[model samples]
Every structure is written in structure tokens, then in C-alpha cells.
Target: MNEITSHQCNLNIWAHLPDKVWNRVANIYELMPGWIGYIDGIPHWFGQEEDDVYIQASVEPSGLSFYAQMNQSDWDSWIGAFKLEATKVLGFEVGEPEDGFE
Candidate 1:
């Protein structure tokens, strides 16, 4: 048997963001590649199954968190693109708290 590892990161956005802000975020997700759909208000990508190599986003107390079963290079590129889009669309910089976002 083999073990699978999941990589995770958080963006510096509030969990209880306004509906309008969430709507904009949803639009950004929809425009991105591999966006399957939202399940239970969480955005999923590639596939929505447990065994799939996919990306999932959830609202957490600290911020919006992303979990993925993907290669490090791919994950970096995807997350970087998301941050770029978010910064452009949301009118503010979006990044991890550890990355000096705030």
C-alpha cells in the first residue's frame, strides 16, 4: 500500500467575506482551468472524488484554504495564477499570510 500526501495553503482573505466578494471569487474560479463545480459551497477542481488528483478550496477561520493532490511545481503555478487573478479582480493583493500579504 502507498500513502498519499496532500499539500495545503491559505490565502489572506477573511473567511466571513461578504456575499458580493464571494460572488466575485466564484467568478474567478469559474474562469480558471479545471473548475469542476462547487459542492456544499466549496469549490472543487479536476474531479470531486476522494481518490482523484484534484484541488479543493474551503473557508477557514484564518482565510481561504486550498488542498490539493498535485505536484509541487504544478501547485505552485496554479496557486500563483490564482493569486494574480485575485489581486487583479479583487482590487487588493491576495497571498498567504506567511508571504507578507498583511
Candidate 2:
């Protein structure tokens, strides 16, 4: 969707992590390249950055959160790639995170 357009769908990707992993989660995003500064103060990854879709990511206590506005197919590909990367960087299985879209 265009930046100016209101998001019709909301997507959330969340996972509970270990205590140690919690502290490092924020750094992962910080060190990663190609992300929009913020969308209303939320760290964001523009669709243009990877695939024509927008994604927002943040870290919570023992959890990782990702918000986005995009179609199912795009979300699947995007999140799938994220899991793989997280597994490599975090050194864990990085199993499928819980997801919701509407």
C-alpha cells in the first residue's frame, strides 16, 4: 500500500523469547540496514526496503513484535525470511511466531 493510504489490514508477529535474548533483540534491528526512521515513533521497515510492503518491529520484555500492513502472500514471505534471519543472528530455532492479521 502507498504511504499516504490508510492501512486496511493490521498484521502482528510476536514471540516470547528467553531473558537473555530479550536484551539483544533491539540491537538486531538497530544493526540491520534499510529501515525507515519511524512511523509515529515506531521503528519501521518500508515495503520498498525488501518487497513492496511495510513492516514495523519492536522489542518487548522477552518478546519480539512486528507490525505491518500488507497482503497474506507478502506477509508470509516477509515473516518467513525474518524468522530465518533471527535464527541465524540469535542462535536459536526461532520457531514460528504467533501472528494475527485483519
Candidate 3:
């Protein structure tokens, strides 16, 4: 048997954004690779395995956070791209709250 480890990251996006705005975000998710649609209202992604690196949009007190479990390089690239697209499309800065995105 073997053990697998995963990394995680989050994006501090407000969960209460208007439907119109969320609709735009949905469009962005649609274009992203490995998007598996919303499962139980949370966006899900196909990982390397049934239990490997993956991504999920989870609603938390702070906001709609992105929980990603992938290699550092891939996570970095994917999150960067997502942040760029989200910032451009949403017309607001999208980033980790810890990064000063309050």
C-alpha cells in the first residue's frame, strides 16, 4: 500500500455575491480544466485519482473559498490563472484573505 498527500489553497471570494456575478463565475469554472460541476452545491474537480489532488469550492464564513489539493507547481499555476481570470472578469481583486484581500 502507498500513502498520498495533498496540498491546499483558498481564494477569499465573497459567497454572497449576486447571482449575476456568480453566473459569471460559473462561466469561468466551465472553461477550467477538470471541472466536474457543482456537487451538493459545491464545485468539484476530477483529481489524479479518486482520492488524489483535486479542487472544491467550499462556502465558509469568510467567503467562497477554493480548496485545492495538487502539486505545488500545478496548484500555483492553476490558482494564479484562476485569480487572474476572476479578477479580470469580476472587476475586483480575488486572492487569499491572508494576502490582504479583505
Candidate 4:
């Protein structure tokens, strides 16, 4: 059976951005061509219904909180894009996603 794995982190840099910027960053995945909306608010890709991959994020006082369950390739792609988007939109250097959760 497929097991759901998770990773969480504090995106401290995100705390400094304005609401508009934050919204833009948060919606990056949603704007992508393959993203599909789910009531659960977890991030996922279209045509991936048969896979167990999933992701979710939220704004926190320190920064942003991100969680995802996916394979290595998916995690690398998704997390890389997320960092890139955050850096581009926020106009700052985003840090690497620390392995595991705090």
C-alpha cells in the first residue's frame, strides 16, 4: 500500500511580504496548468488521482508552513518550484527546504 509521508517547515522570510505578494506566492501552484482544486486545501496535480502525492501550506506568524506527501522526483520538482516562486515574488533569497519537520 502507498503510505503518505509529510514534511513541514517555517518559511520565516514570508512574514515580511505584503498580503498581495503572499497571495501570489500561495497561488503559484494553483495557476499552473496541471493543478486541480480540492476542498481539503491540500496541493495536488491534475491527472495524478491514481498517485498518493499531496501538499498543503498555510501562513504563519514566523513565515509559511508547508506539508507534502510525494515521491522524490515530485518532491524535488514541487519544492524547487515553490522556493523559486517565493524568491521571485518576494524578491529575496529563499532557503532550502530543511529535511523533515521542526
Candidate 5:
């Protein structure tokens, strides 16, 4: 997809992330049966089942990860503010990784 950025560096960026936003997404949370995976060497804190799944907002430009397929109702409950809180904690904003460097 045009949104997902490729992590060309050689490091696990998610591992270095603070437990502020996507640690669960980095270590757990299943998007689908065999659709989740751990990605290495890049920004965005997520893994995927494969390179073909176009899940939204699953990866972060900061190399942290998130889930795009949470229960819709559950996600609706706090996903927005949760993002705000998490971003506030990180002193950064979450967006598609196309504007600049990590």
C-alpha cells in the first residue's frame, strides 16, 4: 500500500520503544488468524502475517506498532484519545511515515 513505509535500517525499532503505546502491539494482539507478524529492521512497531495485508495504521512512523483490527466497538471506546495520550507521552505525533526520517 502507499501508506506503509519500508524499514530499510537494520534494527528492531519496536524493542527500543517505551511501554507507552504499542508494546502490546509489538509483542501481542492478533489482527487476524495468521495475519499478524513481527517486522524487523524498520520503523513502526508491528509485525504482519505477510507483506500483502493492507492493514491500516498498523505501523507507526516512529517504528512502533499498533493494531488496525481491534474489535470495532472496543476500538471506538478509546482509540482516539488513547492515541492522543500515547503521542503526548512520546512527545511526538503519529502519522503515515512519509514526511521525514525516523
Candidate 6:
């Protein structure tokens, strides 16, 4: 998780993204003051910079699951909006995004 940095916030959010990607992005996400979320039920964290990007996977899980990465330029508010949308899609009580990148 130490590979993420201010420069690598624009990570891939799909299931096929390479493991090295999250391994790098998570470092920055871990260091930043951001939030924790579940994109399509996969755990994720926002990256450095305001509305920078959200990285939604890691190397530990090994194989792929579902992921929903947004465009780096997309409004964070839009991503924030996904919680409610995802809940409806996922049919679970998708909780408010948690602020955990403390």
C-alpha cells in the first residue's frame, strides 16, 4: 500500500486492472485524508487530491471481483452519489461513505 502517491491517483476501477495498479494507488490512498467505500461491494478508498480518483481494489484479494473506478476528472460528488444508486442496484443498505483515510 505504500506505492500510491499524489501522481498515481488515476487508477483503473475495473476487475481486470493489474494488481500493481492498486498496490501503487493504495499507498497514496492510505496516506491521504479521504473516505472508505464499497464500489459494487468491493472495498475502496479515495485517492489524493480533491476529487482526484477512487481506487477500488488491491493485490491481497488476488483474483478479480467487480470494481467501478471513475474518471479522475469526474466530480467527487458524483462518486458520492453512487452510494445511494449502488444500494438500489445492490439491494442492500449501502451505508454512507465512511471517512477512514485518516
List the candidates' TM-scores in order: 0.87, 0.52, 0.81, 0.63, 0.30, 0.25
Query: What's the count of clashing pairs in each model shown?
Result: 0, 1, 0, 1, 8, 3
Q: Find the 10 residues in a row with the least total lDDT in model 5.
A: 4-13
lDDT of 4 by residue, 57-77 (tens): 666675677666665666667
After superposition, the stretches of candidate 5 with alpha carbons farther than 4 Å from their true spots are 1-62, 98-102
Point out the higher-scoring one by lDDT: 4 or 6. Answer: 4
Give the runs in model 4 whose Cα sits over 4 Å from its true position: 1-4, 13-16, 32-34, 38-51, 96-102
Candidate topping TM-score: 1
Which candidate model has the greater TM-score, 3 or 6?
A: 3
Backbone clash pairs for candidate 3 read: none
| Model 6 C-alpha lDDT per residue in residues 42-83, reported as the tens digit of each score | 556564224445555433322222233455334344444544
lDDT of each: 0.84, 0.55, 0.75, 0.61, 0.39, 0.39
lDDT of 5 by residue, 12-55 (tens): 23445666445544332332233334345332222343543223
Model 3 clash tally? 0
Residue-level lDDT tens digits of model 3 in 1-102: 123346555666777778988888888887787888877677877652366778887667777677767766776777788889989999999888878887
* Pairs of residues at least 3 apart in sequence or in different chains that clash in candidate 6: 1-27, 4-24, 4-28
lDDT of 5 at 46: 27
TM-score, cand. 2: 0.52
Error of 4 at 22 (Å): 1.7
**What local lDDT does model 4 show for residue 8?**
60
lDDT tens digits, residue span 1-102, model 2: 324322322212234546566456555565554565665666776654345567776555334556666666666666666666666777766653343221
Model 3, residue 17: C-alpha shift (Å): 2.0
Better of 1 and 6 by TM-score: 1
